[model samples]
Target: MILHGIGLVLLAVVTGTLSVLLAMALIRWWDAGRGTRGMQLPQGLDSSLKPMVLLYRDQRLVDATAPARALLDRLSVPEDEWARLLQWIGPRFPEAMEGLARIDRSGRFECLGQSGTGSATLRLLVEQVDSGLLRITITDPQAEYAGIVVDSMSQQAMEEELDLLRRSLDQTPMLVWRQDAEERVTWANAAYLRKAEGQTDEPIGWPLPRLLDSPRPVPGAGTRTRRASLNQNGAVFWYDCHSHPVGDQVMMFALPADAAVRAERSLREFVQTLTKTFADLPIGLAIFDRQRHLQLFNPALIDLTNLPTGFLTARPTLFDLLDKLRELRMVPEPKDFRSWRQQMSNLESSAATGHHVEEWSLPGGQTYRVTGRPHPDGAVAFLFEDITSEMSLTRKFRAELTLGHAILDNLGEAVAVFAPGGQVVMSNRAFRDLWPGADSLGHALACWQNQPETGPGVDALGARLTQPDADLRDSGLMASPQGQLLGWSVARLTGGRQMVRFRLPDPAQQGGSQPLLAASAG
Candidate 1:
């Protein structure tokens, strides 16, 4: 009996122990299953738990739930948080604000989002928390309960975009900033911050330093730009600041314009130099643009054309300038106004194509040489030079040469001039009649040697004319094939030239030649 009792006791203890172990196992299994069910609740319960709620106090966001905050983070606006919310929800629920206003009296109100295909229907619930506070809840029943999956995806995309924008703004060399309605700096990019920090050694704080002194009452709507200068480290840096209005705020951008400023300064200096040079030039210079407008002129042009200083400075057209010259009697007179206009047109056309030159003789006995040259970009330049003195001198020299030739032709002697190179320089009419076709010294010598009575006297005359540094004067006599007595003399002239003269002894003067015969007899 004692053994039976002990065995029963041991069995009972084992049964109790096993029962306790089984109960603990059942509890753990139940807890695990309950936990899993809790993790994935029904869609309705899930939506209720993850509500998007926003608490606002006098149009200012005081508190917001995680989901509501996440939604606001996706919005990109320059307005405050409450404004951003209203702007985003207004499109979906046009009567959202009116409903909120009536919520104080109605206690609560619900707004259904506009119905659209392929989009989840949204619900906006507004309730008065107090006299000055309101609570707004936004829900989408049609959306699936994706838990953190959808949130993570949306958050990732937004984060990537935010990162891209941040990097771009920071890397850009331009200074970018945003200001509120009261002109308080709300946000600025990295470049702007750096510049602010450079202005002062102190650490930059809120309301970033104003790098550019933009005009007041910032322009609304369209972009307005102006140049601003900043002194950094004792060096002046120029920038082109562009401002644009966004809602009640303004976004400003400043681009570096140092290179452009330097280029413009250089161009101005170069133009000044050219103007000074043109002022001193003797030739009248006029430059006309492609549109036939007088773009540039020199003082010499005024002096030569006798146009008023004010008229030239007024930037007259080509036709206007020409008419002014005509009125001043500076241009050559034409038969009629019609022909003059046509001539002017032709002159302009010819000048644009290539080089053109024309001479104008004024009634005042002045001559002008007008030259037209083509410039780059279809421009034309005209140069006027006074050549009256040169023309007069040329005419006088030509008259003197004519008189000399006439005097030689009337003389009884045939005269020919030879250059140092033995080439015939000039001959009179008498020389041509005496020695037909003797156009050159060599030809004339051959002709003289062909004479029937030619002797050593002819040879001696040729030698005297051909030899360099010969006697200054030489004379001889020769008889033609017709027995005509020809008296020849060679004389040296200036510039190493020789003049040879052949004279037919006059019968009246032949008796005077007897001394020459007696000398020959001696």
Candidate 2:
């Protein structure tokens, strides 16, 4: 009987010890579960594959992984009650909120959200707990789309945007095309077809490098522009292609530049012709564009300005040209450099008016006439003409006239010359001494004042002498205003010029000669 009692006691001790251990273990497990909200953290989740964030029923942050925090910056949540938070999300993610109001229901949603970082397309999973708490979870990307069809506004928006972009690309003036990684043309716009159909209609399915004489602007270059030329139907065309890479494919936009190329060629030819024409011109030609840069110059410019050949071909500015000229003593030297700079600017500005004329007396005893005239498209042209001969001849003519007057001053008798019109051609100092108040040269004969009041005045006599059929009475003797007998004789000279001379007899023999001639005649 005692053995049976001891066996029951041993059984009781074993049961009590087992009960305590079980209770301790249950308490430890419950304590651990309290911190984790009674849910296992899904042992060893692939965090690298997808970030995750969990929310409590109280709308408090429960836990988040590394990438989850970065993504949460994009998901805006109002700091309010859990119900209100769910309501706020309901409008934007109505599908995600279907079971949000209930703790026992489960729901899933995908949405596009905006935050500081940019746009974020995310997914939300809502799960219920036995403790009446909501377990909200977030993942960056949802599972692959299955049989359940879900269309969102973001998807519609992307499709509409893509459609609009396609339309815009078609309407654009440039020829937009896409090429595969092999550099073969796959698709093209209408502009590309219009340009490529010049000789043939097969642009697609052709390699871009074959169509061009040279493909790629530079080898091993990144996305950039290249000028390409093609010959089709006996015509050459040019295109400036803008290229960029789009994931193993190249997107190219070709701009039509054939007209621009032709225009440039025509301009080049025209410039050559102008150069040839200006080569033969005797005048120096220098043309400056609107920007005040020397564009065109002729050989005569070098000869006139004494500038070096290389200096002109170097494409110098107007100011630079002036500075060099001043250095070479070719142009007028400026007293002050600062003031001359301003003056130089003014000269160029005014030269565009096309009416500027200036004379430059160079240091080499030469004179130059510089003229500036405006040309097409706001250009200025300077022409230098040598006028040294013209100036020298003018000076010589004046000197000879002065010398002739000096010689006439030493004469004794008074002399006068008249043209066919009775106008006094010239009168010298001898004539002026004979008649103190006689009219100067070119004086009219109709208004003589200091002559004798005979022969119907000097004007009538001169008129009769010059008449085609007048009495040849161009010579006669007349008394001066002082009652002196002056024997005047008029005779015709060369060039339709007539001369008048006065005779002053010897004072000792004049009275006896008159009476002797009279007695011999009797």
Candidate 3:
């Protein structure tokens, strides 16, 4: 009986100790749920009942209600929650940051947000719960009580989209930034920060440095684009900057333009070189574009055509330039103005397909050989060359040749000139009649040797004519197959040539076998 009673007492003591420990645990938990650093809420407000409330310890997020956590999770930034939250809120409520800065001294502050279409007015309440803890409360009194509910699939898709946008902005080579009305840089992408810092490994701070210097302020409406340059570590980098206004601020983008700038400079230098070359040319050059407008003209063109520099500089059309030339009497005169225009049109059409040349005889007795050639891209180039001296020399040569031929025809004796190669160089009319078809020296010799009435002297005549250096003159008398006495002689002329002559003996010396005196006289 005594042992059973001892067991019942021990059981009662154990049960009482268990009940006391359970009560202490409940009290500690209740106190922890109230707030941090012994903070107490107002009589009618409960933290669990509030939809949007965030608790921060210094720069780190300690806890947040369901709706507040959802909002912070939607922000796509590499920064901590506090920084991301501030960035989103500072742009909309500019004074909010200022209020938070003074929160320590004032203990608490409230900011009223502007209401928009289908949205309630926001109320932001920031309080310093303790030295190291801060509480931010966001509320909308006119909003209905609705739960922040999102399906798993929808949440995943939104997260993926946000990640893509964030990655794109960070990885793009272009520099991008946002600025407020006061010209303070509020946000910048990774590329912008890297260039602004210039090879520094230091962490980027808020309010990024401005790299582009604009002469004028960014316009408020429509996009404004301009060329800008940045100097980094003594190296100059060029960019084409574009700015667009977003509400009261501006968004700027800078695209690399170094290659474009270099290409444009090279083209300008090439054009200048060509212009200098054309300026020094002797031939008058005029180049017309596909539209037939005069695009380029050389100084020689002005001197040759006698057109004023001011007139040519005006870039006249093809017809207009031709009309000006007509007025100056630089081109050949046509019967009428209409025919002249049609002729010029034909000249342009012909030049487009191939080379076209026309000779212009001016009133001043100057002749110009005008040549038109096709250029690349449907352009045409005209070259004017003065040919008056050339034409005069050609006419003089033709006249001399005519007079010489006339003198040769009047000769009474038949004459043939042979080149060093024994081919006939020239034959006069008398020679052609005497030796009806002897076109060469060999043929003429054959005709003479075949004659039955010819003497043995014919072979000696042939040998002398064939010798290029046989300077000694030879003469002989022979009878033609037609029963006429003929005299023939061979003489060497200048330039290694032989001149052979055949003539009928004079009536006074016809009967003598003594080689006719007529041959000796020749």
Clashes counted in candidate 2 amount to 0
lDDT of 3 by residue, 53-103 (tens): 899998699998876887788786956898888975775466798899898
Model 1 RMSD in Å is 20.1
Error of 2 at 162 (Å): 4.6
| Candidate 2: residue pairs that collide | none
Tell me, by TM-score, which candidate is best. Answer: 1
lDDT of 3 at 485: 72
Worst 10 residues of 2 by lDDT: 144-153
RMSD after Cα superposition, model 3: 19.6
Clashing pairs for model 1 are: none
Query: Runs in model 3 with CA error above 4 Å?
Result: 1-148, 199-205, 214-221, 375-378, 396-522
Can you give the lDDT of residue 119 in candidate 3? 41
lDDT of 3 at 341: 89
Q: Report the number of clashing residue pairs per model.
A: 0, 0, 0
Provide the TM-score for each candidate, comma-separated.
Answer: 0.55, 0.45, 0.52
lDDT by residue for model 1 over 319-359, one digit each (tens)?
Answer: 99999999999999999999999998888888999999999
Error in Å for residue 158 of model 3: 3.8
Give the alpha-carbon lDDT of every model. 0.82, 0.65, 0.79
**lDDT string, candidate 2, 1-522, tens digits:** 999999999999999999999999999998988978857544444343443545564565566555445444434554443544455356546565545544454334334443211123555666664354555665434332332223232343456567778788778877788877666788887666666676566563454333542234334577687788877788777888788777677778778788888899999999889889999888999898887788988888898888999999888888898899778887656778888788767777778975888877777788888888888899898888888898899889889988887776666667777776656677777676666554633342432334534333244344645563566566555444444445566777888877777655445534433422332232
